[model samples]
Target: MTLYQLHAKQRLPISKQEAWDFLSDPKNLKVITPDHMGFHILSGADRNMYQGQIIQYIVKPFPMVSTKWVTEITHVKDGGYFVDEQRFGPYALWHHKHFIKEIPGGVEMEDIVDYKLPMGFLGDLVHPFMVKKQLQKIFKYREAKLIELFGKMEKEENYLVLRKI
Candidate 1:
């Protein structure tokens, strides 16, 4: 099976605690995500993030297509990093890790997502034109939303890279 990985990094002019507080709260995900995605938490998001926590949501990844996504917060290290894996979602496999570190004047946040689509060959064929592009747009929107919420670090450019693994 072909597994795709997405790596994104951004530096924010905020304290580690500040970044942790905002990111650790599940509700803030909607704030950072694009509105057109129709992302909404169904349950398991009333409290702060913790290991074993399960969050359910509805997302419209494509026009006229809505799906339920359930993810488990598999790992969490206070103020450092956390991992969330798909329990029930569109992808055949989804493993995402979020990392935060204190930088010179602020905090740097990084995300690594490894996933595989379903339908085998059919999935692979559509990935380049559909799935990959969609993911790129989503992350781009996220990057812009984050910049709007918390000012960016001076002269530091955020980046996102997707590759096969």
Candidate 2:
């Protein structure tokens, strides 16, 4: 069982509270996610996030196969950070952390995901060619959509920066 990690950070032209409000809402996930992935939240998300919140969704991670995913929000800090873990999903283990902090111009949002596949050796073998690439593409799409929605400020070396005017 090999664990893979992915980290992504983005600077948004908004306050920490605003960033938390958006990301903490499970429904907003479809907005940032690519449409082809068929991201949809099956849980009631009309209220603010709290620990023990369980969210379900159906996603087509593969070409034609639809996979049901269930995740639980385990930890949440009002305007700072939150953690979500997979209760039942494609991955054998899925733990994601979202962090938001007030920066000079706006807010810095960071995502950290640690996941492991079900099939041990086979999963590791296919990860590089398929799983990893797919995740990268998904995250890239999300980054582009966010830039489009919030407007880009300056293109730094690695992270996308959005400044408030």
Candidate 3:
């Protein structure tokens, strides 16, 4: 089995509390997500994020292909970090961790997602050509949306890295 990991970090000119408030709220996901993805919350996102919280959504990852995705908020540490695991989704496995910390003039948010594609070897074959690129595009859109919502840090460069583990 081939497991892929995507690591993304961005620094925004906002307070730690501000970042935590926005990131911890499940509803804000739609704001950061690309509109082209046709992402919508089906349920389990009415209140604040908590452990064992389950959120369901409908996403169109590809044209004419809509899928239901359910994820559980497995762990949450207030303003520090949180973890979400896929209960049902397109991927064979998905474990995502989000972390935020106070930086010099603002806060730095980091995301690490470890996932495995379905269909075994066939999944591996398409990773480089399709899945990887799609994920990169999503993260790029997220970064841009974040910067638009909360101003970017001056002269700071954020990064995204996707690799096999």
Against the true structure, candidate 3 reaches a TM-score of 0.98
Collision count for each candidate, in order: 0, 0, 0
lDDT of 1 by residue, 46-138 (tens): 999999999999999998999999999999999999999999989999999999999899999999999999999999999999999999999
lDDT of 1: 0.95
lDDT of 2: 0.81
lDDT of each: 0.95, 0.81, 0.95
Which consecutive 10 residues in model 2 have the weakest lDDT in total?
156-165
Give the total clashing residue pairs for model 2. Answer: 0
RMSD of 3: 0.6
- Sliding window of 10 residues with minimal summed lDDT for model 3: 148-157
Model 3 lDDT per residue over 1-165, tens place = 699999999999999999999998999999999998999999999998899999999998877889999999999999999999999999999999999999899998999999999999999999998899999999999999999999889977799999999
TM-score per prediction, in order, is 0.98, 0.91, 0.98
Positional deviation of 154 in candidate 1, in angstroms? 0.6
Inter-residue clash pairs, candidate 2: none
Which ranges in model 2 have alpha carbons more than 4 Å from their true place?
155-165
lDDT of 2 by residue, 2-46 (tens): 888888888777777777878888888889988889888877576
